[model samples]
Target: MATEEKTLVEILEENNLIDLAKYVNYVSASQAGAIATFSGTTRDTFEGKTVVELRYEAYVPMAIRQMKSICSSARSSWDIHSIAVAHRLGTVPVGEMSVFIAVSAVHRADALDACKYLIDELKASVPIWKKEVYSNGEVWKENSEFMDRKLELGKTNGSCCRRNVKVETHGTKSCCGAKVKVADGAAAEISTSDAGTEETI
Candidate 1:
């Protein structure tokens, strides 16, 4: 007789608050010897600026799809038993939890490594946006991991802005008749004249 495979993958989006314990408990199992978790809390400050709160927005369908992909990727790389991921949208006050991740495996190493990879990949690829509200102003934030992936995609597919342009070490100035500006060695903004749209990458 063959034993059944036990696997759990949950991707959740909540407007209210998130309970970390729920995720930890969900990943716990009899066969799992180790469980690892990550809790992301909103801080009170950023770069010496006082942060009032953080507001998160996501393309719900795409976010969930990407999260599922990430979980599948983790399972392929490690012998993970389960994975639980929860992200809170809307307003999250200072010191409040914004995201939580939990992973379980038969060994400590697999659980720990998979937990880290899940969060990192989620932040890098998920279609989630964060708005940091400071005492004086508010700004949208982007993760470096996402930016790096964008650059990598541009290099690999050669479809940046649907044009084949030379990618500079610092930045690509034009793509599909759009001007791209990379700030501080990171691609920060892209503007297109045809669409009259400006976006932050």
Candidate 2:
């Protein structure tokens, strides 16, 4: 069971750039000609205004599962050696890293290509969402960018949801106790037995 699952999923409460680079170093071997890594960070400004901080939220389980699936998919599609992906959550200030993707292969071309695809697919299919906070207001980045490609892949693969995991309308309580509603009804309510009330999904 453990072997079937990728061991790269991690919760990064701190900076991702360093850890990501570290992971990249760890995954790359001498057998590989090249190792590629991409890191995304919060900029001080966007569209001509000073940016403050950014908040990221994700459907945790689904996001991690999707990342693993992506790595597996890339491995199948390309001649990749090893892959590691890490994304940061919670409040991130300007210049803080947001996401990291790395891929190593025997050839530089495959490594670069797979790395690009990994980041693009991560942005498009993975269930992670980011909120950009600016001086004036905040905006939620569209989740639609990844939907079409994911659906197409689902059709090719027969389904998007992995085995034993069904996509439905569900809500999840965040680590901070905030409830996030899922349109697919696949989320579940998480509450402690000692709590006064059970949070609704």
CA RMSD for every model?
12.2, 9.8
Off by over 4 Å in 1: 1-15, 155-201
Best candidate per lDDT, number? 1
191: Cα error in model 1, Å: 35
Per-residue lDDT tens digits for candidate 1, residues 174-200, read 111212223432122222233222221
Q: How well does candidate 2 score on lDDT at residue 56?
A: 72
| Cα TM-score per model | 0.72, 0.68
Q: By TM-score, how accurate is candidate 2?
A: 0.68
C-alpha displacement of 35 in model 2, angstroms? 0.4
- How many collisions per candidate? 0, 10
> What would the TM-score be for candidate 1 when compared with the true structure?
0.72
lDDT by residue for model 2 (9-28), tens: 44354223336556676556
